[model samples]
Target: MITKITKFITPALLTLCFAISLNSCKDKPKKESTIVEEKVVYPSDIIPFMDEFKILCGDGKSYNDLVDVKHDNFFYVENDGTTDWVVYKSPNSGVTSRTSSNTRTELGQKKEWLPDTGGKLTGTLKVMHVSTSGDARVAASYAVVVGQIHGTEGHENEPLKIFYKKFPGHTKGSVYWNYEINTEGDNSKRWDYSTAVWGYDMSVIGDTPTSYPEEPKDGITLGEEFSYEINVYKGIMYLTFKSEGHETKTFTKSLIKTDFGKSKELPEQIKTLYASIGRDGSERENAYAGELQNFKQGAYNQTNGKDPEENMVWHTGSETYDGDINKQYKKGCYTEVWFKEATVGAGTPPEE
Candidate 1:
């Protein structure tokens, strides 16, 4: 009887201890989890001068306040390992400014000034990508305008436009600038005269719709770093372009004087380039004089879906996917530019 009682009591005690252990576990508190959120970096943070300007996106969205602001896939800050760059991206087809048909994800200066009261703009950037699909014969195809001095009054034309163009299947591209003539009469008759910096001018094109010209010998490649300074002082425009391996180029032009005032003054390149389009209008005597102007910087996408036959100089027969931004980006039908540094202020005298 004693042995039986001990066995039964022992078994009961074991069962009681097991139940107590389970109950204790149920009464105990649980450890809370800790979650950490990442801090977001904005374009304004990278480029502190963003507050000085306004932005016009490729989708026609305009923003006056850019502090801590960012637009995904269009205007944003990107980290390329060591440095943070402000990326300006736009599709081949999207909402464009009222004055032009090309779409841009670009910044416009809020302060306007005249040619006499000049300003300076500088940028250190790299052309990451240009539209891959476009008619090779079209001058504007596979190209983008990276900088400009745009007029706000008079004919509201662009006095200066810095362009980067690379044909399909070419490893390198051209860097050039165009000066649009302030037409003496109708604005529709205005035309641009292009000058090359590192490669061929806007007049160079392929023989056929798809054929590409020879690769430029000293052309700039994608992801190459280049710097440009636009200094306007005392009605004179000074341009300086510098790259690591290539030659540094400097140009001077007078903003108050007209170089193409008469039809006879039209350059042979312009005459040949615009002959097909019939835009041989001469510029006014006072070119951009007294006109309110501002600086613009970013990816001004030159590629479009317009028929090349209509306007060979401006039209680009590129794939648009019916104005879809995502589809165009996915298929490389867009332009992307990355700027590491930029500044805008009063123009200073050029170094003698």
Candidate 2:
């Protein structure tokens, strides 16, 4: 009778221990739910072109490795809630290119080509800001250069300089392109011929710094989306400008030769625009033909902190504070631009 009772007590004790172990397992805390947030993609992540080009930032820093990388102030990525844009910003008084009195946060293509072989470059962008301080009588006042095709060899002149300019107290700005003259004899006599595609030319400015012009009813505003294609093929460069709610304008120019070889052949617009600056020279017979050229796209600020009296046309009397980036940008002496998409490649032949 005692042995049977012991057997029963042992079985009951084992079952009790098993039940206690199960309750302990159930009381343990579960792992906290992992929450993963999405990462913000940058401009280089969207358009990786580190292998094809080099970047010159507004801070005077050159970047050869740009893939998935960005600079804090000069070059960075901005997301406007719906779209991510590549921003190129430059202060008016910072370090600049050797040939011009401008600063840029722009891309320089690694490859070069001649007019005969040709090349194509396209960009969809908008001008966010330009220097707000400048003399109205100056041509570069309140203006920013957004794109260019610069010659790498020879005179190292620029074949194209696209600009977006707005006057103070105006609601809309102008979209124009300039063709720099390849001087036949003296480079000092060189000038740029501006052609308006959407609004007024560079010459349309106020009589004084305080005076104002009528707002362009059919012009582009700040942060408006616009695009340009510089396609050079078969010795001719074809340009296409497009923006929503505006006319799609197309233009063609001969890169192999100039149509304004003589003063008499110069377009009347050039005389009116360059008269104040004393630019009366004509382009060469063969314009930019056979010259090694490359594409440049980004914010090439036309404004500067120099004295307005030195060179009224290109020298802007904006606030530079001796190359202080913080002071320049805060004082509205800076240019900022954003690009959505871009491509660079060989020019495609048009179908006959």
State model 2's lDDT.
Answer: 0.85
- For model 1, how does the per-residue alpha-carbon lDDT over 205-289 read when each residue is reduced to its tens digit? 9888999889999999999999999999989999999999999999998888899998456799988888888888888888989
* Residue 278 Cα positional deviation in candidate 2, in Å, after optimal superposition: 2.4
Show where candidate 1 strays beyond 4 Å. 1-31
Best by TM-score: 1
Q: TM-score per candidate, in order?
A: 0.91, 0.88
Cα-lDDT of candidate 1? 0.93
